[model samples]
Target: MSLKCGIVGLPNVGKSTLFNALTKAGIAAENYPFCTIEPNVGIVEVPDPRLADLSKIVNPQRILSATTEFVDIAGLVAGASKGEGLGNQF
Candidate 1:
């Protein structure tokens, strides 16, 4: 199963920075608020020794690692739940 995660917080709260560090996508993180209007998605493979052991035991042609998806959305502001900022849209 694939796991999904989201990085959300107030404007300019290092959400993109955290996503960049996690996925290394480097999708332009700036100091200004709302730098990321649209949500940025990145997938990272999870490394597990159990998977390798299973691969060796099953001897499959190819072994695929599990993945986790990270989404970096626009910063949320007060009243975001009320559709104040772009966070609601994300």
Candidate 2:
């Protein structure tokens, strides 16, 4: 099975930074528009102290916390709706 997530916003709104934080992966973050032409995506294990504590107490063979995916896609402009930039992606 597979899961997916996405990050989108106006250019330079910290979308890429947040994406990096979420997935703990490095993606090039550049200024100005159209910096990201293709999307950047990553999957990572979630770090949770509570889940670790529960595992210690319950002694379950398996422990699971929520995992999240991150994707950095190109931003858009108002003309996006009219087919400009990565607007079609939006």
Which one wins on TM-score? 1
What is candidate 2's lDDT per residue for 1-90, written digit by digit as tens?
235788877777777788877776777777777778788878777667898778888999887667667778888667888887667574
Worst 10 residues of 2 by lDDT: 1-10
TM accuracy, model 1: 0.89
Candidate 2, residue 67: Cα displacement in angstroms equals 0.5
lDDT by residue for model 1 over 5-84, one digit each (tens)?
Answer: 99988888899999999999999899998899999999999999898788888999988889999999889899888887
Q: Model-by-model lDDT, in order?
A: 0.91, 0.76
**Model 1: which residue pairs collide?**
none
Clashes of 2: 0
Cα error, residue 19 of model 2, in Å, equals 1.8
lDDT of 2 at 48: 71
What are the RMSDs of all candidates, in order?
A: 1.4, 2.8
Scored against the true structure, residue 37 in model 1 reaches a CA lDDT of: 95
TM-score of each: 0.89, 0.72
